[model samples]
Target: MASHLYGNYFSTRSQRVLFTLEELEYPYEWHSKDFARGEHKALPYVSEHHPFGKVPAFQDDHVKLFESRAICRYLVARKPGHLTPPFAGTSSASLVQGARFEQAASVEQSYFEPPLEKLGFELIFKK
Candidate 1:
């Protein structure tokens, strides 16, 4: 199955998704947009793919996905058993496994990320 990633070098969120794809050995076409020119803010790219006109919009056979984190999750779910085991939706044991994964992910998002993100914004992006 072919997939496309729309992004540019400057977006850290885009890089995150790109890194995950590389780590998973998932082959995809990369479509670079001119961020300086605000090309991503235009139509079709924004309206058809990403509602927010964000960089790192992803499209595959099944769906078009926006948001860097969601794109990463999709890549993992699409090809499980490589880096991560498949989320078995039909079994209770697997459901518990999913819950635990969610818990850890929640901890990272709720606790670990906020301070780090703030620091990153102040130190890196807010120049």
Candidate 2:
């Protein structure tokens, strides 16, 4: 029920949410809000869903959520299966793993963003 996806297959953030949803076994409505075509900049739905013009945002029950980690945590709490720990009754090791996951996720973001930005310009813009 949250906002739908709006990015291509190669979008790491988008893929992360999709895989989380899949692991959670939650059905969702999916959309591709392609930034390469400037839809995130010009589309009305883009503004309606995400004022900041970012992808992987979600809408549900009139409440909106943003960011990939937030979305993943949301799904994990709402439809937790085996992909993540429980919402409030998590144990210490689970909490530690959660922290570790977050650390790795942050590192993944830090590691990939610049190269992807360069590749984006090179592959999509430098023509």
Candidate 3:
């Protein structure tokens, strides 16, 4: 079965997942959630997709997931050698490359996204 993404166009989080899907050339269906009407906050979206009523909830044949980054990770892992370094091999160089990739991802999540989100909220959403 094809994957399904429940998200809003206005959500950057949703865009992230969408971008990942496109970059990986993954076949999927998009379900646009109406944030203006609070569709994300209502059932059965809240119960089935995201507990916090967030955008970019994902479902595949094998699993269901929320959070854009996690969904992106899963997608990338599904089709390796495209967005990620080849760490499947047991070589030391490959291990180091994988560690570096994880470090960079952690830095972006921990150090970059928070401030950038705040800045976007202040500069764009607040205005």
lDDT value for candidate 3? 0.92
Write one digit per residue (lDDT tens) for candidate 3, span 1-127. Answer: 9999999888999999999999999999999999889999999999999999889899999699999999999999898866975576879988888889899989999999999999999999998
Candidate 1: list runs displaced more than 4 Å. Answer: 86-93
Residue 46 lDDT in candidate 2: 59
Sort all candidates by lDDT, best to worst: 3, 1, 2
In order of listing, the candidates' clash counts read: 0, 4, 0
Better of 1 and 3 by lDDT: 3
Which candidate ranks first by TM-score, i.e. highest?
3
Runs of candidate 3 exceeding 4 Å displacement: none
lDDT of 1 by residue, 10-75 (tens): 787899999999998899999998977888998878888888888889999879999888899888
Assess each prediction's global lDDT (C-alpha) against the native: 0.87, 0.72, 0.92
**Candidate 1 local lDDT, residue 14:** 93
Task: List candidate 2 segments past 4 Å from native.
Answer: 1-3, 86-101, 111-127
C-alpha TM-scores of all predictions: 0.80, 0.66, 0.91
lDDT of 2 by residue, 1-127 (tens): 4445555566667888888877777777787776678776675765577677777777666767778778888887776567655334478877888788778778867997779878988988677
* Candidate no. 1 TM-score: 0.80
26 Cα displacement, candidate 2 (Å): 0.9
Predicted structure with the largest lDDT when compared to the true one: 3
* Sort by TM-score, top down from the best: 3, 1, 2
